[model samples]
Target: MSINIDIRLKKACKIFREGENISGLILLQTNSDVKHDGIFLTMEGAVNLQLSSKTVGIFEAFYNSVKPIQLVQYTVEVVPAGKIPSGKTEIPFELPLKPRGNKSLYETYHGVFVNIQYMLRCDIKRSFLAKGVSKSLEFIVEDRRPVKKTDREQSKAVSFRIKPESLQNTRDKSNVPRFCISGKIDSLSCRLSDPLIGEVVIESCETVIKSVELQLVRVETCGCAEGYSRDATEIQNIQVGEGNVCTGLAIPIYMVFPRLFTCPTLSTSNFKVEFEVNLIVVFEDDYLVTENFPIILTRH
Candidate 1:
């Protein structure tokens, strides 16, 4: 006889927050009567950090590995089965998802070098010598932090000024060589679905600007005592200006943050996720100028 298993949540929504209760039902189907020792279900959730060494050194490459740092994990038994002689059977369950003390749940994130995920898994126990049925589902955990209102006077515009002479010796010189790009974001906070409005001004007579683009970058930091690594991904890129842009020129920038690829800023003891607006300017001389402005994202 063939066996099938299905999971259904009471809310029918996979999205949940901290301190929330997850209630669901497990459905089992069989073509004919079957006997089993017992039935058990397990639910596990945690943050997995996988790191790799990009260096060509043999020792460094050999040490690279995937390290799963657990944020929270819990398991429970579902049912004690005796015998099954039915076409369909249902098992109900409830699980509590709680964040650590004074800690918040981070939004689900995925990147080339890093990923933060939360998943629920269900396993069915079968007799020995037979493979057990298993299934897993991914969910989103969002943290809703209280945002302090900004004063009317301080909400005008947030400006970013980058100068080549003021850069420190440890800074990467290849990004900002001989040009200054100053920009202003309309506000310091924005919703994930809202559009970000800003303006940029380029000032440099020696360098000929070839193109200017705006990028929505997500910076994910993950580690725990062993070592820490941070990676940034350009989620969205928009061309705002092109051609010779020198001798004082202004460009207007507008970009909409997508909900699928973007997440609100969050921080935990194990990891943190942050978002920023980056302005990249390429000059004819092959030099580049990058200016970044930090912005907070909220759920609408």
Candidate 2:
């Protein structure tokens, strides 16, 4: 007899979040009456980081290996594996998705170097020489919290300034800057659903000011020969000046963080994930100035 299985979630989409209920139905169909040792289902969530190093040193290279780290994990058994009669059967389940107290549930992340995921597995136990059937489903989990006044105090605004002569002294590029940008954000701690608000002041250089931009950058690091790397995407941009920038000019800053793509800053022994606010300045000579401030993204 042919057997088939499918999972049905109470919600329309498979999307879910922490501190939420996960309730669903397991549908089983068979062409004829089927008997089994038992049937079971399991739900699991985990964060795994793997690092391999072959270039750390000759001795380390000889013993190069991947290290696995589990940042979060949750599991539950839905049904204990014996069953028979079946044209179709439905088994329902309800489970809370949060981990233990004080342990934050990380957002689902999949990277070339690290992975965080959640899933459900179903197994049909069979007797004799028959093989047991199994199936699995993956879901997205987002974790967000309310921001408190205490969280605001943890982030401090960073400020800096630029001079026109600083741009001309390319001879001492290491010490001189073309333009100086100084600003104060409302707070460095932000939510994925909240707007980032701040003000920026620019000191004009010899060249005409083109535009100013803000970027949300994600940096992922692993214990590898290259160490760590970064990816930056523009969040917002506007023209603050046309000709030379006038000193003491205030430019208002506003940007909404995307809820679906942004992940909170996280760190582990073998891997680290972080987010930052980047300010980019462009001049007529194609001269550019960039300033960065480390920021923490939290649900709360």
lDDT leader: 1
**Candidate topping TM-score:** 1
Query: Where does candidate 1 stray beyond 4 Å?
Result: 54-67, 84-86, 100-104, 112-114, 148-156, 160-182, 201-210, 224-227, 242-252, 258-262, 283-287, 298-300
lDDT of 1 at 157: 80
lDDT by candidate, in order shown: 0.70, 0.66
Model 2 misses residue 241 by how many Å?
10
Query: What are the runs in model 2 whose C-alpha is more than 4 Å off?
Result: 1-4, 11-21, 29-37, 50-66, 71-88, 96-107, 126-133, 140-151, 155-160, 163-171, 174-183, 199-205, 208-211, 223-252, 284-286
**Tens-digit lDDT track of model 1 for 1-300:** 767888788876687777788888888899887777566655555556544354224334223334554555666767666666679988888888875455445666666545667777777667887677777777777656665465223346887776776554536665655766677889768776678888888866356778888989888776555555677778989999887775566688899887546776666555667788878877787666667777777664
- 182: Cα error in model 1, Å: 5.1
Q: What is the lDDT of residue 87 in candidate 1?
A: 94
